[model samples]
Target chain A: MNIPTLSELTARGETPEILFWVGCAGSYDDRYKRVTRAFAKILIAAEIKFAVLGPEESCTGDPARRAGNEFLFQMQAMNNIQILNGYGVKKIVTACPHCFNTLKNEYPELGGHYEVIHHSEFLQQLINEGRIKLTDTTAYKGKKITYHDSCYLGRANGVYEAPRAVIEALDADLAEMKRSKTRGLCCGAGGAQMFKDAEKGNKEINIERTEEALNTGAQTIAVACPFCMTMMTDGVKAKEKEQQIKVKDLAELIAEAQGLA
Target chain B: MIQQILFLLTLLGFAIILRKRIVQISRTIRLGRDVKIDGPTSRRFRNMLLVAFGQKKMFSRFIPAFFHFLIYIGFLVINIEALEFIIDGLAGTHRIFAPYLGGFYTVLMNVFEFLAVAVLVACVVFLIRRNVLKLPRFWSAEMTAWPRLDANIILITEIVLMLAILKMNAADQILQHREPQHYPSTGKLMFSSILIPVLEGYSTSFLIFVERFAWWFHIIGILAFAVYITYSKHLHIFMAFPNTWFARLQPAGYISNMPVVTREVKSMLGLPIEEPGTNEPPGRFGAKDVNDLPWTSLMAAYACTECGRCTSECPANITGKKLSPRKIMMDTRDRLEEVGRNLQNGGNGLDDGKSLLDHYITREEINACTSCNACVEACPVLINPLEIILELRRYVVMEESGAPASWNAMFQNLETNFAPWKFSAADRFNWAKD
Candidate 1:
């Protein structure tokens, strides 16, 4: 992946148009790595000069903050803000709402100010600008696809239209769940709940949320946030319908439609 | 003169009980750490009107909302009758306002009668909903015997109190017809007039006794209810106003970073840290006890109606997690009350050694929360359980170093690698490669 680093770009006295924040899930989670690759490919295809923080990028400290580790969250956030300021980064695009939300909303208080855009919004913008073209014979054409709203992306930040617009650009039939948009249920990986063992309950939240998605009868469940992708994918597997129902990130769906994957 | 002396004693008793309860509650609320809650005055008033008086959030569900509205309006309007009762009791007079206002007083009594009936009906329906219908949220693991009994007792108390008013009116109407000198004929009481016929055959003395007994019972019950409510979820009747007024005006999802912790980080980073006069060695990172939380949060605890609206909407509770937002509030209130009692016994602050975190609320319940803010959004009175949960989690992580293994690893990755992964941050952009 010949992705340029801000440090490298700064060393060469060059600046990318946008900084690509490959969040922990994008950079590490095996399933979400494809989402990272797919989004990167879209950026390359659109001829957008973007650079990653590379080794300089750290966790947005969202989980730490949510888990109530204020000291750790501040520690991590301060380090990232210093590095971001050092590189003179202005605008950021990331594949995770957890990162997008923190960097955009939280870091400014700690003196890290930048225009952070979630990948869904960024993809919608690219499509609107006519930078990328979708052709016929696409896998998603006329297929029933349902998008799961990540809590951070949907209710937490109200970025509902962009992801749906990006999915609509694929010419796929979007199936709306009973609980969608503002009423969307969590994929169960939000807050710091992703890291802790779920308390005793009659059902796992992911299973219930996945049930809502499957009830839509969509062949493919689309997710914008990497966390949602992981959760929904687990949900699909739990229901033993992995072969029938495919869980893919919106970027992957776009990558497939544009033949960038 | 004897009647006036007895009434004064009753009034004095009520005042003393009310004063003691107010002092206790104010002391408990004072136990919380100070967090300035200044905001636009207009916005605060608007929130109180909308959430508290308007019952805006309750309307999300039609049936319960209707019943709740009836009870709430009934509770407020019936207080008018209480005012009249207090005046008549103090002056040793019967129907003092009746002759002054004439027909308007009759109309006022009718309206009060109508509201009392509505409130009675609403309380019965509420009792059924809690006990007979067994709403799942109400029956959660947290809704132990005391909470259930407390709710039932409140409803039953209101029912008896309303009946006492009607009985008193019925007996008084009969006495007025027989002996107009002693008991003035106050025209006709709407609901109680029907009961007049039921008590007509009794002797004039017996009728007066029944009227007097019912009147005294009604007033005493009112006084007792006032004090009992402080110990019950009914505290929300009063706390909702202040709780709604002090609610966070910001978006539900916006989490506030601690300024004290922020300063420590800036200092570590060699940034110009603003030192605000070293206050008790930077005082613990997050809330380990009730004293560590913001005063509004403690007020929220005291204000919880235990309606379980937050738990009903909670994703964690729905998913079978141990977390119940209602329980969090209940635990907080319980701990505050305990601390208040400890202080009354001459215990010196949090030095009595009991704390809110372990003694009242468990780490398991707090950990199960997903921080979705559904609980906060679901609460009609604007109580933020997430705030309390987050503070406790902070204590676990910062003070006890008791985070789960996976979380600790992620923390290590965040510290050393700048990401929540063991792989180097240098490989972050590798996803861009084919």
Candidate 2:
């Protein structure tokens, strides 16, 4: 896979249509790295000339802001915004809702104005435009799959349908947990909770959320955000249901249906 | 004549106590950082009306909300009777509004009497809920003897005040029938009418004395309760309006950017930074103590009813986390009061040798928050305990550099690699490379 950086494209006197914000989790987390690969394969199949930030990208300082380190958050945001503004980057697509939310909503006020899109929305757009198609006899077809709503993506930004639309594109059976939409429970890893230990609680939030997903009897738990991907995966492991139930990102399911990954 | 003298003296005493307490509260609130609360007036007023006056959020739970509404309406409507009581006390008159209001007076008194009994019942039910039933939310780690006792005292005070009003009406009814010298035929108090039949067998002089004693006790109790409420969570009765008025009108999930940090970022990014030359102190990044919080945040602390709705909904608290949003507000109020007392005792403000950060709210509690804004949403009076939690976390990160090791590693990665990973930033797109 030949992925061009924004800097390289600019140096070549060319510009891509969109900048792929490969967030830290997608860049480094082993599990989420698969999500990144799956999403990139889908993007390539869609024939969208998207460029990655590569070394120019940094953590969106989402954790800093949530953790109340404003100085640090501003420092990081300023650095990334300056780089984006330098490239005249007009649009951004990220796999992490934390980055999608911060870049789309919070950054404009901080002088970083760009059209930000989460990969789930991007995948749905691809499917809607007929750029990517899924086969009827795909591996996940008719499989019981439940989508877990990430707090930042669902309640924070109200991006519920796009992810589910992408999931439906897989021709899979979509079963929803009781707490699916606005009332969806957190997967024990948001608002900088991913960085710290669970603060001496009776039951971890991810475990509670996982139990909800499992109760739906879905063989596959579909997620859109990398943070939720990490947390829900950990939850599945805790339940020791790795073999029984598989936690997969929507992008991964799509890629499998398309024979891309 | 002597009675008039005693009434005036009592009025003066109440004025003194009320003034002293008001000064202390205002001073403590003023200690917080200055913030621009003046904006979007229409929206603010709408929130104040809905949350404070309408008690809109409280209705999410029906049973308790209905009972609470009774007391709330009673407290507001019955204050009309206090106005007449004040006028009668000042002029040494008996039922001053009785003649002017006529039949309307009877109807008004009847409503007030009915609400008085309703308030008494509601207060009794609340007391039972807190002490006897022991609702899980009210029995958290931070809700020790003082908060529990504070709630009980407020309820007990309301109950006694309601009973005094009823007893006074019952005794006054007897005195009026007996054609006493000063006792006037105001009207029948509806709910308190039951007490008249019971008191009918008593002597006329004893009835007059009972009426006078109950009257004095009710007014005095109200005055004392007013002053004492400033020191209690019951201050929400008054502060809720302003707290809700100054509430955050933005999307619940959006936290505002700090101006001080914005300028510094602008400077770093080669953007046009604002030129600053003012007598204002240097901007502190986050709160180190209670004074570092915004005035509205301090008001929120005072307005907290210690209901623990925030904690109960908190993902961390449900999982048995040490962090309780209710505890954060309670600790803030407690620390603010401590500072006020210290200042009152002739101690320097700088050397209280303690602060809300380490002394009251711990590192464990602030770090545990997921910043989900659930606590903020659950708050009936619009108290954003998350703001306090965030401010304290800021202090830990920026000032003390006291975050856990994993956090420090993440911070370093963010600084060096622009991500929360140890890999080179150039490797970010490796996922796209198969």
Best by DockQ: 1
**What is the C-alpha local distance difference test score of each model?**
0.86, 0.85
The list of candidate 2 runs beyond 4 A from truth reads A1-19, A37-51, A115-149, A154-184, A200-202, A215-222, A250-261, B180-189, B255-271, B277-284
Name the weakest run of 10 consecutive residues (lDDT summed) in model 2 chain A.
A133-142
Every prediction's TM-score for the first chain?
A: 0.98, 0.98
- Model 2: per-residue Cα lDDT over B1-434, one tens digit each: 67778888998999999999999998999999888765689999999999999999888678889999999999999898999888888888988887788788888889999999999999999988988899998888988998889999999999999999999998887887788567656677677789988999999888878988998999899999999999899999999998999997755556667877787677766778765436576656688898889988998999999888788877788788888999999999999989899888888763678989888888888888877666776788999988888888887887778887778887887788877767888777677665
lDDT of 1 by residue, A1-261 (tens): 688888898899999999999889888788898888888888999999999887667788998899777888888888889899988889999989998889987899888999999999999999999997876436888999999988888767878899999989988899999877866788888887777667778898999999999999999999988878878989999999999999998888888888877
Each prediction's TM-score versus the true structure: 0.91, 0.89
Residue pairs with clashing backbones, model 2? A58-B418, A59-B418, A200-B320, A201-B319, A201-B320, A202-B319, A202-B320
Runs of candidate 1 exceeding 4 Å displacement? A1-18, A40-51, A87-90, A120-145, A158-183, A200-202, A253-261, B172-189, B276-279
| Candidate 2 lDDT score at position B73 | 98
